[model samples]
Target: MLSLNSSAMYTGASALSALAAALLGTGTFWPIGLLYEAANVLVAIIAAAAIRERGAAGH
Candidate 1:
């Protein structure tokens, strides 16, 4: 749940950063956008691990 929440937040942030970059025509937002994307990937990995653990425990 926490992972999912974080993923959602990071995804939102990334989208906003992209929009800002597009509007401002600056490369500055690119790095922030990349960072957010990386965070989202990490959160997704954590969520997958948690789900796998839960499934294993259930069986």
Candidate 2:
């Protein structure tokens, strides 16, 4: 369940970032793009940690 939840969260964040980047265009307004990218990375890290904890608990 945790795995599925994390995957969904990661996927949603990625899709949102991509959509924002496409709509905003990544030129002079690169800070917003960078912010989205950073958010994606943060989400990935959090999901990974959750998955890892879930795995460890089964052992």
Clash count, one per candidate:
0, 0
Model 1: lDDT of residue 56: 100
Report lDDT (CA) for all predictions. Answer: 0.81, 0.82
Best by lDDT: 2
- Model 2 CA deviation exceeding 4 Å by range: 1-27
lDDT of 1 by residue, 1-59 (tens): 99998998899878977766675676465666676688789889999999999999999
Please write out the lDDT profile of model 2 over residues 1-59, one tens digit for every residue. 99999999899878877877776774556777677688779979989999999999999
Cα RMSD (Å) per model?
A: 5.8, 5.1
lDDT of 2: 0.82
Model 1 gets an lDDT of: 0.81
